[model samples]
Target: MLDLHTHVVPAGIPFAASLAADDPRWARLERGTTTGDVLVAGKVFRTVPRVAWDLHHRRESVEAEGGTGQLLSAMPELLASWAPARQGLDFARAFNDWLADELPGHDGFFTGLGVVPLADPEAAAAELGQIAAAGLSGVELPANPPTAPLHAPEWSGFLDEAERLGLLVFLHAVGSPAAQWFPQPMAANGVLFPNSIGEGVAGLIATGALARRPRLRILASHGGGSLPAQLARLDFLRDITPPLQELMPEPATVSARRVWFDPLLFDTGLLSHLVTTVGADRIVLGTDYPFMPVDPVAVLDDPALPAGLADAVRHTNPGALIATLRSHVQQRS
Candidate 1:
């Protein structure tokens, strides 16, 4: 089994200390003397786990779970894309360096998806080349960054650079002000943050981004969020609305199928809908490992999926993505 969506916090990096005194968007980690949990911006964020830093522990855990490989990206809070361009660049470089050091000599059990400082396009593009050179397959970009959404005009350069480098751009949702309008904490945090991926997809289709960057590889996490559920509505609006028709000449589903999605949706019913609408070949197995604790293998093996589709989601679809990842890992090995 291959788990595509796992995260790691680099050991010995004082992520919060890198920020200036006036920087308030992110909190520095304050390790507890007695407790395993680390406080971030005065709130208890998470208990630091050895698997988050220890390769031996992580490898043993994955082996026990029958996982052959795992892709490592930075934990979302560490992204700090909202910070100043200079700071963002520094953090990104440090993170990517740590990834390069940890990943290059290791066996094929681990592959890394590096990070970019989206606030600075030139720096981001430059770093993309460095990351590719470091033997990472791709970069994990925030779907709704503090500066702009994934498909906004400002992001075209970054997207172009990614395509040029043949990097798989994984769009993971990070919290934003717009997504917080739901008012209720649970609703905003749980429902809004995850489904914001839908907004990113809609923006991509409406802005003709997918059409423009045909070679860009985008893999959406959380079963493409609500895009699978909203496919028919987008198609209907595109057909009837003159403005949308011009922007989206083809059906939304058609453009959507061109991208890949992780089957991390909690609901099997929603996963079924995604498989049917997005095509099984475009669906890949992702567990959101250590965060969601859902088994990708069990989700794929559900009796609800067609037999062929079960195999495709479990292996073939992910193999398409992994094939690209393997090139980087093997190059370094």
Candidate 2:
């Protein structure tokens, strides 16, 4: 089965602090007596996992997990859009170079979804052209990039560039520093943070970004993070709120269908509900492999699912999402 929402690290890419030794936003990887943690400005940001860079073992693990193939993206933590433009560009180039190196040897099992310098959208668009030519399907992006929201007017150029380049945008989210603003002892510093994915999707819908780029393929991670549930409410708000009406002016539900969601909700009922809301054709199989504690294969194998729904999620839908890249990949093999 095809797995879309998996992550990987380049073999020799350094910690952000090493790349931008002078940038305060960059984090250094600190090795401790028992564990490793990333320190940003000399404070512990988060602990990391070995599988983040353990390529061969990750390959074997995915194989054992029964995936025929996976789309590899740099973990969102490494997306480092807050870095200065030059440093960000350097990191993006290194990430793309590593993927280019890795893809030639592993024909069917690996597909590269490279990173971009989102801090500079013009540069990002230019690099996306190179990534497309390199046979990668698309790029992975943080839903809440440092520069702006996904649908902000400043992002229109980049969105148009991506659409023009025919690259699918995989929108994933990591914890945001803004999580601190929620309240003391908030779960947001951990679990609730990534719900930014939902915020990004809803923001895009509310602002009519999907309508502007009807053909722009976006695969939202973390089961599109509460977005499906918020669809009706967003639609209602659009009608009653004059400001939202001016922005969206159309039903939010119509725009929601433009996105593809991965079934990483970690619940059978949630997955079934998402499938029903978005339709099976718009759902893809995603494991968040070797990271999140969910079983994509088990979900697909659930006997309670509608007939052919599992197979469609596991294979058919993904194939359609990456149709051009799949054809390119088949030609290479």
Each model's Cα RMSD = 2.9, 3.7
lDDT of 2 by residue, 1-333 (tens): 788888874435453446746765555565544345666666776565655565565677667866777888876767887777778888888778788777777755778787888787778777877787777778898888888888888778777877776677899966777667767524673465447788888888888888878878788988888787789898777778998877785688778888898877767788788787878888888877656654545776677878898889888988776676666445544
How do all models score by TM-score?
0.89, 0.84
lDDT of 1 by residue, 1-333 (tens): 667778887665444464634465553444443324544566766766667766667888889977788888887777776678888887788888888788755587888899888787767778888888888889998877767777877778888988887888888866667555776655766776567788887678777788778888898877778786677888888888989888876788888987888887767788888877878788877776666544544666678777787667666777778887676446644
- Candidate 1, residue 37: how far the Cα is off, in Å: 3.0
C-alpha lDDT of candidate 1 relative to the true structure: 0.75
Off by over 4 Å in 2: 15-20, 23-51, 54-56, 178-186, 189-194, 239-250, 293-304, 328-333
Model 1 pairs in collision? none
Best by TM-score: 1
